[model samples]
Target chain A: MSQKRKLLVHIDALYRSALYLTKNENSADDLVQETYLKAFKSLQDDKEIRNVKAWLFRILMNTFINKYRKDKREPSLVDFDSVEAFHESIQEEVVAPSILDGESVLETLVDDDIKMALKALPDDFRMVILLSTVEGFSYKEISKIVNCPVGTVMSRIYRGRKMLKEKLAGYAQKYGFK
Target chain B: MNCNDVRKYLYAFLDDELDVEKNIEVLGHSNICCGCGRRMEKERLLQKRVRETVCEVKAPAYLEQMILKRTEEKPNFFISVVKKLMSERRLVSLAGIAAAIIMTVYFFAIPGNLKKDDFLYLAESKYHDYMMMPQLDLDIRSQDQEVIVEYLRKQTNSSIVLPEIRDNAKLIGAAMSEINGVKVSQVFYMHDGTPVSLMIICKPDSGSEDSKNVDFSGMKEILVDEKVVYYDDKGFCGHCKIMGWKEFGNEYVVVSKLNSDEMIKILKKA
Candidate 1:
């Protein structure tokens, strides 16, 4: 396959993440287009990219942060410091051992519910979550992609998943699903 | 492991991030503990739901077409060549020599027959080139004034002094070449997000044939700090302003999109 064709293979994954990050289809489309342009230029230089998916994602995330982030009306609700603060207080609010012992109502929570929950998250948390839970990038790969330490990536994933579950549980309860 | 310890590494265990020893420990504990096992299962189910929800989104068919079309467009030939050559340091001198020959032919082919407007055109063209691709042609990319001046002096074999323009402008870099045996240096700067070029040309000699080869008698002259300065507010090319002045027998020209007054206000510091 041509270099461009090989990159297009991951367009679905990139686009999906872009859609969730920007929360706008037009911005997602623009972001993906810009990413491909940069990737094509780099490929022309004959640089060897071992993992094209991760490389493409790094470009996408950097471009979003540098350019698109300027238009963001609100900053990431949670930063590394705040997330660390929450980590310190994790022991204070004891996570009951039996809190999630019963069957999950996640199946009853539809796609929209899941998306809204993801969107409601702070940009930082949602980024790590999408990269991990959806894209299946390892903690190491995600740390490289997001340009953060592995421990930070780990903390974000843990907190993000917990928050997502709470939002989904709220949605399920409103839907009268136990 | 106690419930708190198991929960601490629960997500890591579920994500397969834990090492073998830790993974086995979490697995062993959850196997015997009903609550922990159910919790792991619940977390797993939630992750699956999130994956299903997000992965359902596919790149629109048109997006692929749009990206392919855009990426397929060829980059500017000059820019690509310069960018490629910059990566290989050995070829840089050869590239510089070739570029000087090309520029010499461009500006000095009919030097004796040239008019004042031709100088303006040259200044405008060089300024546009520097602004469009600032990094590629620069021989020395430095913000330090002394560094750039020293490099230009060595390369052109001429004494070069850069005017300290204190208008929030930054000295980006400089490129030097011996055009038609006359040393020339182009210094680039950025002020208020706009690029400005300072072209410094070494005078051949007093009444030398090479000195009379290029004519500048037709340009509009003004006195700045008691020194005669040549300027063209009505630029030969587009709306860019071109100003030329003699300092210590060397020719200095300024070209930018700025108006004559704005250019003068900044050039007054020279």
Candidate 2:
């Protein structure tokens, strides 16, 4: 495929992720524009990128992180030890999954409810969920884009999904869904 | 697989990330365990809901077009030229030499017959030379505008009015110089410790060859107080903004490394 054609194909995905990251339409537009510009300029270097979509996502995430989160430390890959510890804690709790039997409740939730739940997520968790669930990136691909380890990616996905279910549970009950 | 094992691989199973053997084991366990199966279904439903909601946001119709337009607009000309030159190193170097020789011949051979406005080019060159020479000194080294103006007036034998730029700049000195055999008065000022030079000479008559050669072609023009002033877009002398305007039957030119906005402010004040 032509370079531009390949790149432009992912604009919708990039824009959606940008909106999730920025939470403002104008800033999302700016972020996506900057991401494309950076990607195009780097393409001139003639480096062969194996996965252009992942590469573009990497650029978008880097731009968003650098431009907006300059003051904060970068979210690194979840350490293996931490992931193990987190998993152990969850196993110990054995808390009943709030989302069990909530399938019909989830179905009742509209797009706006889902968006509000996603937006309510913390930045770190939201990024992973958006990449995995929304854009369908693999844990390995998410690792590369978010510059974290696969273990960290899995942990974020688990926690992020758990958080989403809890938030949706409130909406599910309010909407009269058993 | 027991409930603990099912719980451990539940997320990986939903994500389709488990190995074939592990995937079958998880499926088997979930089938026998109603609770684990229900939990897996809930997670699947949640993922579907989130994906469907997020997917509702397609890029606005204009976003792709805007991005493509931006890419089209930002052509890296210098990089492309460099790439081409690198690929054709031998031929490009030979062509470069020939082009340089042709330009040199064109400049030197046509100077004698060149029109008066051509003198502006010569004046710009002279301006560069004087500005570069460290030994060249002003005739009057005074901060007082009156002293510098009086000195330049007597030296050039022309009526001179020193511009008021006291708020931001101070007078450095004044001098007399000749450009294309025409006497010119030069005043210098210091703005934030940087030197700016202003050159003044009689406005050439409509039919004069000097006036014809002085029109700076290709420079941008803007009217300040109804007087047309021309300034070089890429900066003229030593990266200084050179602005010229004709006022009171005299042509005034100011050259400084100060930015265009500041230069305009000083010129408008003048």
Candidate 3:
């Protein structure tokens, strides 16, 4: 993809990542904006970043950590109860089920199913995986974004995927996967 | 490879994160484990399904407006930092200049111990919780009877240390209080229930003669819960008696309780 198109994709994806990190809309907006500012300045450097999307996500995630997580010393705000409820509610049928087949679910997919999956995963695991997978972040990039060892990034991804698959299984059994 | 290994590496392979060797091992295991193969396929489908379910959210229309406004104001943050650094540099230079001026003036300065004459002034301006003890009860612990006799001898000098107070008082018996530490002592006298305590200190600079309270006032007033003003002048370095009712190394409190009218009279005369 062209750099400009890629930057737009990155911007949208990082916004989702930030939203998942800080459940609050205002906070997510700020985190992603800060990510853009930093990414703009840092992109001026000569280092090679293999995946700009992942690189953007990592910067966004770290910015959230340094700005909000450390300052508040609390897990991201979560209401798993509501997440499960929303997922169950969506089982009646997606507002736009056909949107689920698109390469990037940017069209008209209900944000509820995604929100439900995100809420079920623990905050630390949820943020790391959402940021890495959706953004196609490499382990090294994720390690920097999450401010952890590459091993830790791998462990979290592994565990996060496991938890997500389990939740999806439950969703399938309880609500049936579309 | 067992079903467990198949399950573990299956996700890794789908993520395109497994090396070729691990992919070979996982593919081998999955071919033998029917359940693992089905599960691995479902997991891949689920990964795709999740990405498809999550729609990207864009910044609201106002986000652009906010960024543009903030950008114009952006240089202020860096400019403030530079301003702070420049001011700090100037302050350091000014302080260095002041120190040099002080050093030059020190040699010409009068014996600082003589400055004790201003004590009454600094003490009045300083924060003294005189309310902590409104009554004065003094006792003397002087081994030298001659010192008490001589200090009291001021009564015979016909010079009223506080002349206005002379109408209601003469130098009564010079009493002393328990000397606790460092030649710490209090000379006491009563002008009709108005008390006067002189906290005598044997400072490092001994040659200094008896100075009045007004001389103490000339020194800068340090606002503190209780200040420890270090006076280094005239070859003398002694803490200006802490001006407030504060617990210092010890309570070298010059205990005095003069009523409002009596205090006014004494201060007026002094």
Q: Which candidate is the best by TM-score?
A: 1
Off by over 4 Å in 2: A71-85, A176-178, B74-270
In the range A1-178, model 3's lDDT, one tens digit per residue, is 6343345545567766777777788988788768777766675685777767767776776687678866785444332222221112223322322222333332233346556766677666787677566666666766676654454455456656655645544444444334
Give the per-residue lDDT of model 3 (tens digit) for B1-270. 776456445545777778888888888878878766766665666666566555456666665555445544656788888667668868788778888888767534532322333342222211111211233333333434355545533322211122223345443334322222123334444455544433343322222443222121221232135463322211000111223221223212222221222322333222
2 or 3, greater by DockQ: 2
Name the regions of candidate 3 deviating beyond 4 angstroms.
A1-9, A41-52, A76-111, A169-178, B61-65, B84-270
Candidate 2 structure quality by residue, lDDT tens digits, B173-248: 7666665555555566666544566655543223322232222222233355666655434321112334553333
Find the candidate with the highest lDDT and give its number.
1
lDDT of 3 at A170: 49
Clashes of 2: 5
User: In model 3, how large is the Cα lDDT of residue A89?
Assistant: 25
Give candidate 3's error at residue B156 in angstroms: 77
- Residue B202 in candidate 1 has what lDDT? 61
TM-score of each: 0.56, 0.53, 0.47
Model 2, residue A78: distance off in Å is 12
Evaluation by DockQ, superior candidate among 1 and 3: 1
Q: On a 0 to 100 scale, what is the lDDT of residue A154 in model 2?
A: 73
DockQ of each: 0.20, 0.16, 0.06
Q: How far is candidate 3 from the true structure (C-alpha RMSD, Å)?
A: 25.9
On the 0 to 100 scale, the lDDT of residue B91 in model 3 is 74
